[model samples]
Target: MKALLGLFILMQIFIATNAQRVCGTEIYTQKLFAANPVIKNAWNNAEVQIASTTKAATGFAARDTAANEIIYIPLVIHIVYNKVIENISDAQIQSQLAALNNDYSYSNIDKINIPAAFASLAADTRIRFCLAQIDPQGKKTSGIVRKYTVKDYFSPEDGMKISAQGGDEAWDSKRYLNIWVCNMASRTLGYSSLPGGLANVDGVVIAYDVFGSGEHVRAPFNKGRTATHEIGHWLGLKHIWGDAICGTDLVEDTPTQQYYNYGSPTFPHVTNCSPNSNGDMFMNFMDFTNDGCMNMFTIGQKQRMRALFAKGNLRNSFLLSFACDSTLAQGSALPAVDTIAVLSNKPLPQNTGLKVYPNPTQAGVNIEYIGTLNNISKTVSIFNVVGNCVYTGKLTKEKAYVNMANLSKGIYIIQIKEGSNRLTAKIIKE
Candidate 1:
C-alpha cells in the first residue's frame, strides 16, 4: 500500500510538471482555451478556414522554395490602456520596431554567442516591417492608434473588435498588418489565432506587460520579443517544438520535442525526438526562453515565414506596391514652356502655387512655382505611383524642367523639396 501511494504521487507530479511546461502557466491555458471554442465555432460556420494537420506538410514545403523574396508588411499598433503605464509611449513603439527589424533580419541573433551547430542553420529573413507611410485609402497616418478601454484582458473576440475599429482608423487589413497591444488577462501572457484558424482574426494581440519597456518587466525579457514570437505565429510559423510530441511544427530540420519550455532552459536538454548529440533547440524564438537567451530561426522556419508572404491573402495584398525594379522619373525632361498654367480647380494650402507648361511637348515637362513656393525648393525629382525614383535635379532658381522623353508613356510625380517643405505635382509622359 505504501509503495502504491508513492507511485501515484510521483505520477501526479510528473503530469503537473508536464502540463505547466507544455502550455505555459495554468491560467494561460484556461483563458486561451476558453477563447478557442469561439474560434472553433467561427470555423465550423465557414467564416474562417482552420488549417488542418495535413495542410502543414504542403505549406512547409512550399515556403522552403521561395525564401529569398522580400515581404513588405504595413503595421498598425492599437494601444488599449487605462492609464499612462498601460499606455506605452511612441518611443517604446519605435523601440519595438527596432527590435523586430533586427530580429527578423537576423541582425540581433547574429550578435548572440551560439554553438556552431546551430549557427550554421540560422537564417536572415529579408522581410521588412514598416509603419504604413500611405494607407490603403491613400491617407497619411503615423500607424499608431490609442484606445482607452476599461477591459484589461483581450480575448480572440476582443481582438476582432480592436482590429475592426483600430484598423478602420488606419489602413484596412487588406492593405496593412494590424497589431494590438493591451493589458492581457493575468491568465495568458500572449496568444495568436493562426490566420486560417476558426478564430481567424487579422491582427496580433500582446499583453501590455510583455509589449514594451523593460521597466514594466525584467531585463532582456523586458524587450518586445513577445510580439516577435506571436507575429511569427500570425505569419503561420508554429511553435518550434511542435504543439505536442506527436505533432510536428512541419519544418523538416527542427527536431521534434515532447513539449514546450518556459523560462530559461539549460543547454543539451535531450528529448524523445531530439536525442542527438546536440540535444533539443529550446532556445529558439518559438520556444519560451528568456529574451537574452533566445536567438535564431532555422532556415526551414524562414522558408515557412516567407511562404506566408508568397501565398497568404492578407500578406500578399501589401506586396502589390513593393516590387524592387520599379523607378520614378525627373523634371529635366519636361517640355520647354512659353507659358505655365496652374490648375485652380483643386484646393491648395495657403500661399501654395503650382504650374506646368508646354502642355504638349517633344522633350520633357517644365514646372514653375509661384507664391510662397510653399517653402518647396527648386530641385525636383519624379516617381511613379509605385514609388520608384527615376530622375532628380536642381530647380535652377524658380524653374525646373524634367526631361521626360526617355520615360515611358505614363503618369509621374514631380516631388519638390525645401528644408522640410515637400510638395508633389502629377505630370504625364506623352
Candidate 2:
C-alpha cells in the first residue's frame, strides 16, 4: 500500500512539472509518430539520406557550390483567434519574422551573450525569412491570414491545422512556411510538425500571446524565440537533451545532456551527463529555457537542417518557390527591402547606444547617436513594411533627420550600420 501511494504521488509530481513546460513539440511529435507509423519511417529514411549525402563526395561538391549564398524562405502566417487580442497586429507578426531572420542568419544582437566555451560551436544557418509576397495561386498576399474561430482554445492534439476544426488550414507547406497563431490552452507556448509529417499540416502553431515581442505578448516568452525554436524542429533539429537522460541529440558538437534545462540556468551548467568543465549547452534553442536564455544552434545542428533542403528531400520543394519574387505583378507594391542587407558572412556588431526618436512621427524622425559615429563608413537605411530599403543616407552628424515626406502610412525599419555593426528601430508613419 505504501509503494502504491508513493507511486501515485510521484506521478502527480511529474504531471505538475510537465505542466510548467513551455514547449509541446516533443509530445506532439510522439503523438503524430504513433498515429502514423509511416511518418516515422519517412523520417528515418530522410535521416539515412542525409547521412549518405553528407558522407558522399557529391554532397561536398554541392555544399561548396551554394555555400556562399543566402537561402531565403517565404513564410505565411495564419492567425486563428476567438478573442480580439489573439488576432495579433501586422507589426507583431513582422517583428516575429524579423526575429527569426536575425537568429537564423546569426545577426541577432543578443548573440553576444553566448558564453566563450560554446561560442565557436555556434553557427549561421545562412537562412533568411521573408513574408510571402505571392500566394500559391500567384495572387498577392499580406502573408498574414486571419481567421475567426468559435473554439475557446486549442490543444496540440486538436486538428488546429484544419479549417473545419476551428482552425485555419495551412498554405502549401512545401512552398510556404505556415505558422498558426492562436491561444493554446495550458502552458504550451508552441508546437511544430517535423519535416516528415503530413504535408497539409507540416508547419508550426504558436500561442498568440507568445508569438511576438510587443503587444499581446507575455513576458519571458515574448522575444519571439518560441517560433524560432519550433522552426528548428520543423527544420529537423532535436531538443538539445534528446528528451532523455544522457541522451544524444544526434549532433556531434553538442554535449550530452541529462534533461531539459528550464528557466535561465547559469553558464557552464554541468549536469551528470556532461560532467566536464564546459558542461551542457543549456542555452541552445531546443532546450526548455525561457526566450531570453536561449541563443544558438550548433554547426552540427545547422548541417542537419540544411540537409533537408538537399535534392530529393521532403523540404527540397521550397527551393523552387517564387513566393518572394520581387518582380511578380500583384495587388499593391511590395514594401521596402530589409535594411542591413546580407552583405557578408561576418557577424553583426553589438548595438552602440544609437536611438531613433519621434518614432510615430508624421513629419520626420531624429537619429540620435550617443557617441562618436563619425569618422567611420556608416550609413542609415530605412526599410518599409515589406522589408525593402526605401532610403539610404550617410550619417555626417550626431543627430540626423530621416524625412518621411514621401513615405506611406505604415511601419518602417530604420537601420544604421558601421562595418559589421548594425542597429535597427521601427518607425510608424502616421
Candidate 3:
C-alpha cells in the first residue's frame, strides 16, 4: 500500500512539473502576443485584404496565378552589442543571409533527408532575401549597421529603439528592410513586429545566440534559423498553428497542430490534423524546431509571403516597379560605371548649363548653372549607389553649398533639372 501511494505521488509531481513547464512557455509567448497585438491583427487583416485584392487585381479564378510573382525583400541588419560579440562579422552575416535565401527559395530541402511519404508536399517559397545594396534615396551601403549600447540585453521595446536608431543613423526604412540583432532577454531567441503594425518600426529583432557566429552559442539553435523565422514574421507570416488548436495560420495547406515542438521530432508523429499520412509539420521553420531540423516553408506559407510583397506599406516602399528595375540594373552593372544618370520626368529647359565645381571636393561642392528664372522652381536631387536620396532641395540660386565633411568617401551624383532640361554631374566626396 505504501509503494502504491509513493508511485501515485511521484506521478502527480511529474505531471505537475510538465504542466508548469508548458504553462511557463505559454506565458512567455503570450507576452509576445500581447506586446505585438498590432502586428498580429495586421497580419490577420492583411490576409483578408490580400485574398480579396489579389482576386480583384489578377482577374483570375485561382489563387495560384496571383501568387506566382517572385518577391524580393531587401534586408538591413543592425548589430547592437556590448563587446561580448563585437558585432557579428560580415562573413557571419553573409552566412545567415545565405541560409535565409536557401530556406525561402526551397533550396534547403535538397539538404534534408526526407522520407517518401512527406516528399510530395515539399515546396519552393519563390521568395528571395537580399541585403539592401541600394538605400531608399538610391545610395550604396553594406546593409549592416553596428552600434554600441550599454544595456546588456534588449527587451522587445528596446528592440524598437535600436531600429529607430538605425533609421535616424542612415538606415532607410523605405528601401532597406531593417533587422536588429542583439542579446535580447533571457530565454527569448527572437521576436518580430509584422508589417503595418502599431510597433511596425520596419525592423526585426533577433537574439545574439541564434544569430551567426555559433562559437559562443548553444546547439540545436545556433544555425541562424532564428533570423529566418523572425523574417517570416516580418513578411506577414504567422506561426504554423496560429498559437491555438482551432486557430488557423491562414495557410490552406499547413496542418493544424495543438502545440509547439522543440528539438528534433521523430518521423511519423501523428497529430489531430493528420495532414499527411506521415503526420504534423513539426519540422517546418514556422514551428519551434531545432535549426538543423527545420528546413522548409510550406507552399501555402510561400503564397502568403508572396501575397504580402503584393500590397500595403511594404509594396509602396520596397516593391515599387522603379526600385525593382533599378536593383536589377545595378546588380548587373559590371566594372562599375563612373556615373549613372537617373532622370526625373521634368527636365531643365534648354540653354541651362549646370556645372559642379571641384569634381572631387574635400570640403564642399559648389553648383553653378546658367538658366532662366524658371529654374528657381526646379529641384536639385543627389543620390548614392543604393538609391538613397542624400539631399534634395528647390533651386534658390544657381549656386548651392553641398557640405562633404561628414560624408563618406564615395562617388555621388548631383542632378539639376528645370522645365525640360536635366543635367547630371558626378562628384567624389573625399
User: Sorted on lDDT, highest at the top, how do the candidates line up?
Assistant: 2, 3, 1
Candidate 1: count the clashes: 23
lDDT, candidate 1, 282-377, per-residue tens:
767787666666777776777666555444432555567432111222222221111113343433223234556554455687676556452234
Tell me the whole-model lDDT of each prediction, alpha carbons only: 0.57, 0.74, 0.59
Writing each residue's lDDT as its tens digit, candidate 2 over 106-218 gives 77788898999999999898878888888766656668766656677999864678878987777888889999888898777888888978888889999998887764587
Instruction: Estimate candidate 2's alpha-carbon lDDT, on a 0 to 1 scale.
Output: 0.74
Best-first order by TM-score:
2, 3, 1
My TM-score estimates for the predictions, one after another, are: 0.60, 0.72, 0.63
> Which number leads on lDDT?
2
lDDT, candidate 3, 132-223, per-residue tens: 66544454445665554445676665443443442223255556567777776545677765566543455667766567635544566667
Superposition error at 24 for model 2 (Å): 1.4
Residue runs of model 3 more than 4 Å from their true location after superposition: 1-43, 51-60, 63-68, 84-86, 109-111, 160-170, 213-217, 273-276, 311-316, 321-430
